[model samples]
Target chain A: MWQEPRYQKETVRENPVEEVKKITFRPATDIYEMPDGFKLLLEMPSVDRETLKVYIKDNQLHIEGEKKKDVSDGKFLLQEIRDVAYERVFELGDDIDADSISARYEQGILEITLKKKEKEPVKEIKIQ
Target chain B: MYRPFPPFGSEFMKEFQQFREQLNELLKNVASGDVHLASDVMYPAVDVIEQDQQYVYVVELPGVKKEDVKLMVKDNSLVLEGERKEPEMGQDVQKIRGEIAYGKFQRTLPLPENADLDKIRAEYKNGVLLVHIDKKEETKPRLIDVQVQ
Candidate 1:
């Protein structure tokens, strides 16, 4: 029980070092395919909307942010968990138009909308 | 002092109504998650045992690295503090949903009088922290035998 706090401290101190390493975060995401686009829902706790960064990179979508600590100074009767920085990535499909992707964060959830690319016209074929 | 219609009875009643509304608002704030407390954190299961001349404590902290944890026996209390860092995100992150919990946390437990101050050893393996404490020699119980006719 006591070591839980130590775990939290080390995580905070080593965050800068982790940035250079390859790490994977398991974030629950829901994807919905519609006629016009795809909708994605992401959950992130203790993260401020302004601190989150979402973008597409090399056919993959990336989400990263730093969650600020909620602990106050000069007092503590008990503590068990701490909020830390997080980053997540997702692969985009070929049909998705990268240029038309949009995202919104509200109530600790991130919702992303990706429009599908328009299909090219097909010419009629005649057989002799 | 029995005058002025009970000191503006209607006015006093209006103020009392407003006070009740404010009290309800305060209760709402207290019930919300916005209030942060140590109890709000997820606590790993733990068990402590005392046998013969030693005290043993086992803490289960799955999905947490040993290096990220800190254990300290201070004064008459055992303080445990650590943070569970969120894993890095991959290149493609469409959306995020359902965050259970990831962050810094601390828990402190008071030690009993019979607890040994010295001869303490701690080991962490398989996401469990085991601390062995040897009680003071003077505190150990002595077996006594009596022969009856």
Candidate 2:
């Protein structure tokens, strides 16, 4: 049996139930293989190139940023989304040369190119 | 001495407890995310479609910059991860209601064998991420001519 509520309620409740947050926001990215290196495209909308931070830590690439927040007075009919902060970590492989990692942000996309690390030569010793 | 049903009853309760434990674990997995993981799924509603000619993915990420998104091919899977945050709500006195999920999210999708990962292209316009995986030219079937007998 289904019972419908009699009236539509618009008043906001003081004690709202806390729902589990879904984990989804890591930026939408694309990886391409070029002749020189692998190109990683990151989509970070509304983030300024200067404000964005990118670094490699513990063999993982971490990206952090924050959206601009406003605190002005305004009448609202309806509000849905909440203020957000961003952080993402990517585990890098041994083949990636940390020293050769280079990143550039353009048009809301962070392009990171990971150059292949050169193999080190092994030396042989002669026993006299 | 009537102890026939006691053994069966104990087993049923044990099974029930195990079921409850599994349910709790599942719930915690959904809720026990860090601040960043929560925002990823809460922000965008995305759709991934694989067709005969191309692999198309559509992501609805409003107010997010293109540079903020990071797509990767790790372990033969395509991972879509990003963050979408809403600006602070102003200083107004009002009763608060239900709030949906927010924070960071990571969605990894497996790629098909025919997906031309080498020639992938993506564009974001009007708060939508459109990614196109072009099929390899050699993989496209060509029509053959047959002489009249």
Candidate 3:
């Protein structure tokens, strides 16, 4: 049976200490099941390699990054992109090999490959 | 004595402020006929900034290649067209969940009359595109000294 990845919702604090609160947005993601394993792609614009982090803990995969603002001194005439952090979590199944997971980030896209564990072969039984 | 609700600097107030700003932007876009509510094509978010000498347009286009993008100047508008192709997968691949938008996108922005289209320059880096349009020489703010009578 194939298990779908679950998303974990984060709770916002009722009272924040900082004057300027940093918002976190969930990046768009795509999950695909391959012959050998699973592939995940996340769109995180303005996120660089230095600010991106991909890790696994307790059978859950976490992808988080902070978008760096390049030009801060200019006055915005039309502002659409918000300065926020990107975060998303997905639960991994038992069929995946946690240790064999690999990730790469390029052009603001993070690609992750999770290998599936090898299954046991069945033995043929002969009856007299 | 009257007190402000959400206590001025509270988290809820800050979030409300952010929401208001976003709503204002959305309303502005709608008024300017820039919002496309019925279109299936993805319109990359943009931020236009005004500087001393030039106007900058920053576009967010994650997962798009530079070769697939096309930029042009038509009349008094800057047109941006690009395609974000889906990532290549194996023949037996099965999509479990897809939230990313992948396809051709087009966004046209009306340029100010003072913008010097001849001096336009663009650069793509880290999935972000930066377009700088220099201001015309005569239109730029100039300092003048008055003769003392």
Candidate 4:
């Protein structure tokens, strides 16, 4: 079995203001390892682009977004779809280039690509 | 992705397609450990809302196009069918974490007695599919007024 890379485990965080509690669901995501970097596909339907935030802080990848309410006037008969906010956290490793992270959200899917850092070669010391 | 009781009714319990849906959903509940098993069966989450003259059914289908979804009304039931095409996998790509339920899924619900199948309409937006089912005028509730004698 191929072991997942070190940058896989994620931890959710709370907003700076700790007033009323907000529900945060871990967005269902797919992570794939490419020859050059890693790609993450997340499901976040009904989320607006302006409300989405993706950034890296303290070597942790943070993703947070707000979903707009589309049908607020009607009474819900079957409420399987809850219009809740979403958040995700991922710890980044030295191999990852935090500056190169690129993301795109379309049709409710957010795709993020993280490029890996080039490995450095070790040099041997010469004795005179 | 597991929720509280699914609330699936007896209508779903009686059909072979229901069995497939259950298996697909069960695999999704255990998808973190068994991704391959979860393929081909994802109960796309949905919500059905009631309006004055129509019933609206909404389903979240991220990464799916309108052409990939099919809506049908028959035998007093409404059926939703769709497929999420597998992402193109280059020869060098390797899966590290697979959690999104991919592939085909089907859901059927008993239509209201007042449903007018002829006027059903569907629209896709931001990964959400909305199907508006206009209720027959006879089936819609109307308030009656009586003049005081």
Superposition TM-score, candidate 3 onto the true structure = 0.76
lDDT of 1 by residue, A44-126 (tens): 54454566898987788887765543322322223333344555566677888999989876544567888889988898889
lDDT of 1 by residue, B58-148 (tens): 6655445667889898878888888765544344543233233457778777776767777788876434566777767674477788777
Interface RMSD for every prediction, one decimal? 13.5, 19.0, 5.8, 4.2
lDDT of 3 by residue, B37-127 (tens): 3334677999999998899999999899999999999979999998999888869999987767789999999898889999999998878
* TM-score of model number 1: 0.39
DockQ by candidate, in order: 0.06, 0.02, 0.40, 0.49
Worst 10 residues of 1 chain A by lDDT: A1-10
Mind giving the per-residue lDDT tens digits that candidate 2 earns over B1-149? 76565555878899989999987866653432211132225546455565556777666565565677889887767788876553343344221211233367667767767677897788876456767776665645788998989
Which should have the higher DockQ, number 1 or number 4? Answer: 4
| Per-model tally of clashing residue pairs | 36, 46, 0, 0
Those runs of model 4 whose alpha carbons end farther than 4 Å from true positions after fitting are A1-21, A121-128, B1-40, B139-149
Fraction of the true interface contacts (Cα pairs closer than 8 Å across chains) found in each model? 0.06, 0.01, 0.77, 0.75
In model 1, where do residues sit more than 4 Å from their true spots? A1-25, B1-149
Q: What is the C-alpha lDDT of each candidate?
A: 0.59, 0.55, 0.80, 0.78
- Candidate 3: CAPRI quality band: acceptable
Which 10 consecutive residues of model 1 chain B have the lowest summed lDDT? B31-40
Q: How many angstroms is residue A25 displaced in model 4 relative to the true structure, after the best TM-score fit?
A: 0.4
List model 2 lDDT by residue over A85-118, tens digit each.
Answer: 3445667767777788888765445667777677
List the candidate 3 regions with Cα displacement exceeding 4 Å: A1-19, A123-128, B1-40, B139-149
